[model samples]
Target: MLGAGLLAAAGLPATRAAAATPASTSVLISGSLASYSTFESKWNYLYPWGDSHNGSALMVASSSNHNHVSLSGGVLTLTSTPYVGDGFNYHSGTVYAKQQVLVDSSWPSWEVSGDFQAPSAKGTWPAFWLTGVNSWPPESDILEFKGSATNWSNTYKNTSGAWSNTLTPISDPGAWHTYRAVLKKSGSSNVQIQYFIDGVLKGTHTGAGFVGQPMWLIIDYQMEGSSGSPGPTTTTYFRARNLYLARSSS
Candidate 1:
């Protein structure tokens, strides 16, 4: 016969089980632009300022004469060459993705990634980042060399006050390395951003009031400013391959 205590405990109603959440499915949105025409199809040449952004004091992006942006051997190159144009000393390249990223119920997360071989010499500023298309304050820097041996991962949100940046050192800045960022919804109005280098996790931060907002993925090759004075006189390059965007599907 079973003990009375055991029988009494068995007789009690079992604890109610909690419902499980549905796992998200990752779907590819964009992949590598293998050719120049393909690159043009996926991205816009420059900002609304027309070949210039961020005050345009040092480098002005240009799409003319295959001077700044070009694709060769499956690798996209953004070159910075010394050019006396429009009161700017150097001409470089910048491109913005045609599709914007929106974190909503349909797509609660996103991923942007690329393999980069960027410059580390003085006055060289190359970055892969995302910013608001219609507003500011919601920005994420997946890879920013900042003219040093360190990569800077940053997230900006004015709603929460101030910004956040994490620096990761690289032994060789010109070597090829994978840079990735995953943006997932943390709550109804906030998002958690994670930065990865060479597929390894580097930094994770929260973006305040970033949910339901649309952001444009941008890659720019600039000169001077944060790097150092007297920009590089010789031609410099910012090379990237397999730049892509993915989303979480149902």
Candidate 2:
């Protein structure tokens, strides 16, 4: 297992000196939909990244729309248009922190929490995940969905093995829900990733450590079949608010 501090140290990108320092960050990006698409010749957007295979795209909104996303008052939000494709099979929205926030090496434990809501469609897939800009797989899948109460799963990635488990209370895609996770460095390289739903305990993963790296948080709303279809099928949507990130004072 790796120490959380070492994990944080390992994840820093070479561009670190120019990114935001640990304390806090605040920025706003707003514009019309037509002015954001690369196809429309507007490319000044700060940090918009999406995958066609993932069947989703993201944009900045001066006011708000189907895919309006941003960070305000210490929380992140993702709002999208109504998705009609393949039922609930596909739709997603995502955003990355443009100015990286360094993990406070002084804290032995850290936590990231946020609220999310999926569109009313039956097949929408959504996630609030963390990943290392330096690697993949060992990336954290902190929160994920499958749309089936019997099949919902949350996963945590670690060096030893990929650990996963089932979850229910089944997030209502049409309404808001809160989620939180705590990663505690308890040993040389072992840490625990704890999951919470609406601030209540849901699940926990212990002894998995992939922390010795600089990582970024990702909130996404994915429409099913968007990644596998030969063409666009239907529309999908997601709405979110009240995101929280804090490090244990200990």
Candidate 3:
């Protein structure tokens, strides 16, 4: 099933599952298995005041002329362009799935996976992450590239005050690579998270306090925080596609 209760706020009705449930399995929520050809149909642009971290960029909404986001050939392109507006010299894009909030106990297990081509320019920080709906610390950086040759992926469980991360080496940020995370119940009120890149298992961690609480997704191409000052002088772009999400029976 599509988890109508979760998507109702976004105006998307829950749809019937496309296949039969396994004898030992149930799918709680499933995103479109096909490509997302339009931005508004599945996601909403996020506008954070003052741009988080006071970066040298403004996050803009999707529009016809600005060209901050586009979808073609099953690929969604998110661009960061130089623009002088409101004393800021650059503007970029950030978006979140319409079904934003997810709680660990809502389902037994869940998976989030996608193909990404990171932006390579200096001071360009692009990330696909999850954050607590009501607080910070309970966040997961499924994929984060801080304009470096290495990529960082991590999970944070605030109640336990623990974090787990993996640093993977990469030669080309512009090349498409697969990234995924699986979160499943480990013990009472706790969960184990596994991170993967290009089909290889990268890291694992166990944490509590994430269960039974809400977390929302975030994807953005930011500038000059820990990525350093003076972002790309020219326009830079990041691409992602084949984003898939599903919940499994406990």
| TM-score for all models, in order of appearance | 0.84, 0.60, 0.80
Off by over 4 Å in 2: 1-92, 98-105, 120-122, 149-153, 158-160, 225-235
Decoy 2 TM-score against native: 0.60
| TM-score-best of 1 and 3 | 1
Residue 89 miss distance in model 3 (angstroms): 3.5
Task: Give, for candidate 3, the lowest lDDT window spanning 10 residues.
Answer: 27-36
Q: Highest lDDT, which number?
A: 1
Full-model lDDT for every candidate: 0.80, 0.50, 0.72
| Model 2 vs truth, CA RMSD | 11.7
lDDT of 2 by residue, 1-250 (tens): 5555665687754444234545433222222122234212221221243333244333334324324444444334454454444533323346554423223345556677656664434344566676665655444555566443322335555444765774655545456677677776767665667777777777776635554655666666554442233323454455555545556534
| Residue-by-residue lDDT tens digits, candidate 3, 1-250 | 4576766655664573344655344432244323443556666665432243357777775545337766676677778888777877677877777655454544758788888999856788888887777677577888888768788887786345876778888778689999888888766677777889888999887656777656777677777676776778898988888877667666
How well is each residue in 1-250 modelled by candidate 1, as lDDT tens digits? 4465665666732332233567676644455467666677778876634666652334344445566788888788888888776677787788888888888777888989999998988778899998887788788999887778899999997345778889999878798999999988887888899999998999989999888889988888877878776878888899998887888843
> Against the hidden true structure, what lDDT does model 2 obtain?
0.50
